[model samples]
Target: MPRRGNRLLVVGLVGAAALTSAMAVAALATGAEPVAAGVVCPNPVDELPAIPAGARIQVERELSALDQQVAEANERLVSTAGQGGPNFAQNAILGPLRDKRAATLERIAIAIGREADRPEGLEQFATCALLGEGEQPAPTTTTTARETTSTTAAPEQEQDDVAARIACPDPTGALPAVPQAARAEVERELANLDRQVEEANERLVSTRGQGGPNFVDNAILGPLESKRAAALDRIEIAIGRVSDQRPGGLESFAECSLG
Candidate 1:
């Protein structure tokens, strides 16, 4: 009988060990945090703090304000295409909007007793959605490009005017906006001429030992100088007549066409 009892005890011990290992594997597979033996895992929702009164409303309000800010910045960008480039607009406008949105998310997380260390772009407000149940949803309409011509062209023309107005310095201290198409053409020409000038300079440097002084002067420098002058003339014309005043302290764009 003693021998029989010893065998039963050994069997029970092994079974218990196998059960513990299985539990651990299951916990890991389901991403549940491991708990000490005999301890119960706490429910995640139970860990959240009780919702405070008006918390949801306040969060919604802040979100609305942030949305307005983003919208305004977008409008400004559309109105002014040459507003110091895309980086400038992002830094000056979008960055702040995103930060505010993140802060609102953090605030909501804290109110609901959740960890605020969530990854960006995945912010959630569980209770906030309830606050909008009585409100009507905003209507949305989709319009194809062909149908949007009348509406889109005006904004584009306005953007072009803004670009031209700021592209060149005003001679009489009065800036004027121009057509967007014209601005694009002018900028393109300026860029092309700028490349040509660079190529000419490179050619002049390469011709140093290949020819005599007169040959270098006539074949390379003379033609290059002429092209540079022509580019400058085109740039000036694109800049419009206002630049003829030289303005208060506007630097000469003519230098860009020079070697």
Candidate 2:
């Protein structure tokens, strides 16, 4: 083992290194120009909360929704881009919102990836188990006999609803071609929406029935509220992407909003 003084030196070095790396990452992500290496950020100690091993399933759930959102929207995005549009004003509104939505989903995926780097996060993937209230890991259910059942039957209803929602566009009518700028905006908006939904769902599941500290930190309560606030911020950003002179008839930027 290292001597006391050596251990203190090592601990300080590790903390400094972690803070420096985090600063670089945040700067790059935000597109901020780097300051001198000696310049410290205001909150050097800030760190993402450590995801528990028990939280792996929650992380996975967020990831799955995020991936599905992006996958489902990809074709629709291309279709929107290829079709003729009423122009950037009407078209601009929808495309960007869609793009932001996708980005939101992507963010959830990214967060999950980060969470997975933790010790508990990695172990959870090895089996079908749950972390009990006391941090003890065990098989998911109480009864041993019930554990044999598989749970993959829920997709039929989902698929049916999707098929119903997207009726084929008019055979005779030519859709407007989506401008390149509009399509780019659409993609960005979709990503944003994905993040918003992911955070929301994560909160809902986490906060279900807990109280006190859990209530304060879990998504079911506080996290959902935070996600809601984030969604509003994203919405404002999406709206600002549109021209101010947009015609008066629109109720929303979504496709379903077009009269």
Candidate 3:
């Protein structure tokens, strides 16, 4: 009976030793921070704080903004694609804008990926619905693209105008009158652009105000983005000139090719 009791004690000790080793392995594997040597095992979940709603919202919003930027950029590329005309300055200006926007997207992706060490975070957010989880039901691809177009079209219009204007409206030429068709197209595009901008602004406001996270990164960062903003301003001025009553020349109707 004493031998049997000793054998039972040995088995229990082995089991305890195994558990200890397993726990040690787990700690090392999961980067389990130790409170102290030979002391209490910390609760893993307690070690990390849940991402705050505000922070998450901000991060998510930034992620979306960057993604929207990328999409808009690609769209610009498409818009400018296959054109082999005198739009040399227009295309030239877009080069740097494209590169910078791409860089911004990369940085944003890196930030999203590092949150609490998540993987596929960049892609996740890129593919994630703009409104975040649940509120919109199934992930509708068509709706997302349409919404993206509607959201980004305005900023591009404004920025393109701003950029063109900043290039210093050609003092060499006088203000030209817009062609009838071009005028109609410009008006139509501007109206659509305005509607889309309003939609996007509304989305931004609603997203930020939600109990979710607040996206402050894009809250008027600085002039780096102003280059693009300038482009928008230039575009607006140019469009205004096109629609202007002044009779300068036919150059104002150059964009008539857009149609």
CA deviation > 4 Å runs, candidate 3? 1-176, 210-259
Model 1: number of backbone collisions: 0
lDDT of 1 by residue, 1-259 (tens): 0111111000011122222332333343345564432211111121222223334344334434434444454455456556686376557555554565457556545543442232232242111110011232221111122224324457765464233211122222322353454466556665765576566566545432222223333333334434444555554465564344222222233222211
Q: Which parts of model 2 have CA positions greater than 4 angstroms off?
A: 1-183, 206-209, 212-222, 238-242, 245-259
Q: Give the distance in Å from residue 166's predicted Cα in candidate 3 to where it truly belongs.
A: 22
Q: How accurate is candidate 2 locally (lDDT)?
A: 0.32
Best by TM-score: 1
Per-residue lDDT of candidate 3, residues 76-149 (tens digit): 54565556766542454344444544454455445434654432323222221111112223323333443455
- Give residue 256's lDDT in candidate 3 (0 to 100): 9
Poorest lDDT segment (10 consecutive residues) of candidate 1? 5-14
Score each candidate by Cα lDDT: 0.36, 0.32, 0.32
CA lDDT, candidate 3, residue 58 = 38
Maximum-lDDT candidate: 1
Instruction: State the lDDT of candidate 2 residue by residue for 15-34, as single tens digits.
Output: 23223433443444344554
- In order, what is each prediction's RMSD in angstroms? 33.2, 24.8, 28.1
